[model samples]
Target: MASLNRIWGLIVKELLALLKDPRARVVLIAPPLVQLLVFGYAATFDVNDVRVGVLNRDGGELSRRLVAGFSGAPAFHVTRHLDQIRQARPLLGDKKVDMVLHIGPDFGAHLHRGRAARAQVLVDGRNSNTAAIISQYAGSIVAAFNREALGNGGDAELAIRAWFNPNLVSRWFIVPGLVGVLTLVVTTLVTALSVAREREAGTFNQLLVTPLRPPEILLGKALPAIFIGLAEASVIVAFAVFWFGVPLAGDLRLLYLGLLLFMLSTVGMGLLISSLCATQQQALLGAFLYIVPAIILSGFATPIANMPETVQDLTLLDPLRYCLVVVRGVFLKDLPLELLLPQLWPMALIGLVTLSAAGALFRSRLG
Candidate 1:
């Protein structure tokens, strides 16, 4: 009984000491509220709020009438009316526009003649996930509108084909991009805490006083996790291709190219996170806190178009989202290099900035 009492006393003392730490309290208590809100609202695949540009060459009452309905639909908002197709190109490039509705000049004539009129819908294939969803929604909306207007039988013949992922396999879309996400998870936490752990264990000062240069320390700490991330990526890709039956459509070279740049970005971001945090707990909590939104906002599991208007626009800041485009495009769509350069440059730019920032921070803080 005396020994039991002594053990319980020690346990209570440790608990009390833990509770006394302000940082522990903040890490444990603060995340739940933030995470609950993030997962609750943003974790979804159902896409909405398609920003549609209407190019109406047919200024007839029919064209005018249809434009109102497209805008009025809750799913689509008519952002602008472009005079020419060239005008819409910038919006697509900027990702300000989701889809364009070009009402050809013959639209009224065909409808009047009781023939099928073609309204070409051009999608910003840059964001194929959002592009895919928008394509489906726009087609359905237009067809339903056409049926109602034509007073045809209950339906029109719809033989829609999905180019990249015909099976609509979720993993085909998700697994390739999972490479980036897994890297973020491992790299972010590991790097975020690499320096911080040493500091918390009370070894940081000793290490700082060593002969090793700051860049060497940072690289030495970061390289292990970067290697692990790369291995994990290769395993996941192998599993996806051999086990899950996801075809590696594009050349392996492009896949590696995309993955390489992406990993550089992840490692750089991890190094940056590590330099900012002062302790392991802070590093861990901060990594988890940041990665949750980073994953959601990446459009890996959820389509960006589904997010609220404000949130969708802000997703551009996440490097993972752009990386996802490259992975999915290469692995599934086999998109050409010309097609992927738009995604490639922004991420490389971000990676460079992250590396430069981390180096500066380490020098500033450690020095």
Candidate 2:
């Protein structure tokens, strides 16, 4: 009973110490909420409002109609009308225009003769993904125009459907992932600096004089960060669902289960970093070093399948990688326990190993 009381008092003390400062309270709460709003609205995959150039050598009615199609597309704005094809080359090179549609002199003749009309599209390949999306948008416009011109009463139409995110809004994908990342940034930094801050303030000896064992001390330090992490995560999740309209299709119980396990892994990793550092500056640097690579390899911004085979193999060790899959799956797909077990086991194993290692290190340091 006395040991339980001691652990409870230690936890309360750590929590009070962390929340006592006004700056610390703001730091803990504000950044994650701001990043949630900013990244959700701004970080997008849909390439809209692109500049396009038109070179109409034909200057015929059909050519004008096609030019109007490009101009009317929501994805494109026809910014320049070139008299000569040669004029577009300079704009393309300067990136003043993302694409140029060149209508041939014989384009109307080919259309009237029932021959396939041809248009050349020159795209800037600086950003290949954006260039490809531009091509698709242009192709869609041309295809719709062709269907209208032919009056295809019997032509088979293909209807494309997207699952999970039907509208393919990047917000639906990015906002949930930000929950894991923001929680990671906040929790890791808070826990990573916990030990170092105590040491720097000359409170290490004071802590040692207490009857609290090393594991109890570690728990007192680690639990508060985990609690703060969960609070930050809850705020992000609320904004994602209510403000951004990203639905939480999964069981709330399972989603919280994943969040708990994921935070355990993060807390353990942070404690390990804190145990190795002598000062708060080193702790901050250490957290950055771990976080940047973790975010990259976690397949948040890019698909892991697109990475090299060896790099894909390396991602298996990243707790963030699995946590992202869990959070996204729960948000979009309502993944079942059987489906999530593979990720959960790895996180549990990593938490146990890292926390055990950190506890031993702290004990040795105190000894």
Candidate 3:
């Protein structure tokens, strides 16, 4: 309790110092909002209308139907048709099309006989991940057509009914998650460079020789980032509610609490990175390396279930993944304590671990 009280005072002092620094104030408040809007809307993996190439050798009603279906949706796009099978290689190699669909000469005949009409989708193997997702998307479209064309419906093991977002708007999933994610980047990146800049400008040495303890100094350093992260979160919440029309399904208090815990780890990770790197360039690079992979792996772009078991287990150590889980749960699932415990504890545990590690590193770096 005493330690926390002291940390609180140090945080307050740091916050005051932050207010006095105009540059720091801008860093704290501006970039998170900007990045939230930019990356939240722009950097989406729910890629829509990816260019597709069609080799419709059949030219039958079923082929037209298949072509129309794939082209119709916002997800899969068909722009160019190949005259010959050999034309596919150049198109894919040039990145002109993501996938190539080949409708066989006997496509209509096969479906007419009550047999499964098969179409070969040749995907560029150079980029297998996109190819795999594209294949699954194409397969799903074809399956739906097959079910409709043949009038077949049966029991499936799992039935997915998306609540709140019946259409599964990428923005619904992304905007809420981006609240935490974009804030994490801006807060951490800004804070990570703070110390290095202080060091570069000869201010850090003066700071170290002061009466402040190492933990106090660390808290002071992290204090500004907290405000930034919280502020970013607020901006995104408003954006989600007003612009995107995503409902806030849970108590705002829980959302803020979750944000704070997650930010603790994020700020800690930033401090940890700052303490480790000697130069701002190294700090920026380190932060980028962490951010890119963390965002990609954190169930943001892909489901963690799709990853290999080893990789999924490794994500247990990633705080962003847990934060994303919490954001999604609170916003979409309206998850109570039962559903939240799994997500919250991991964030708290990681915050404890990473913050402690950062504190120790800060002490060493200062000493």
Residue 107 alpha-carbon offset, candidate 1, angstroms:
11
Segments of candidate 1 deviating more than 4 angstroms: 1-21, 51-71, 77-155
What's the C-alpha lDDT at position 52 in model 2?
A: 84
On TM-score, the leading prediction is: 1
The candidate scoring highest on lDDT is: 2
| Residue-level lDDT tens digits of model 2 in 39-116 | 444335577767888888888877788888889888789999898878876686545787888888987777766667
Q: Give the TM-score of candidate 3.
A: 0.59
Looking at model 3, the pairs that clash are none
Candidate 2 vs candidate 3, lDDT winner: 2
Candidate lDDT scores, in order, read 0.75, 0.78, 0.73
The collision pairs in model 1 are none
- lDDT per residue, candidate 3, 117-229, as tens digits? 67877765423345556767877888777766554232111122222454546577668888877977987898789777777777888977789998888889888999988
- Count: clashes, candidate 2: 0
Which is the winner by TM-score between candidate 1 and candidate 3? 1
- List per-candidate RMSD values in Å: 4.9, 15.0, 16.0
lDDT of 1 by residue, 303-350 (tens): 676777677777787888888887777776677888888887777887
- Of candidates 2 and 1, the better by lDDT: 2
Q: Relative to the unseen true structure, what is the C-alpha lDDT of residue 349 in candidate 3, on a scale of 0 to 100?
A: 85
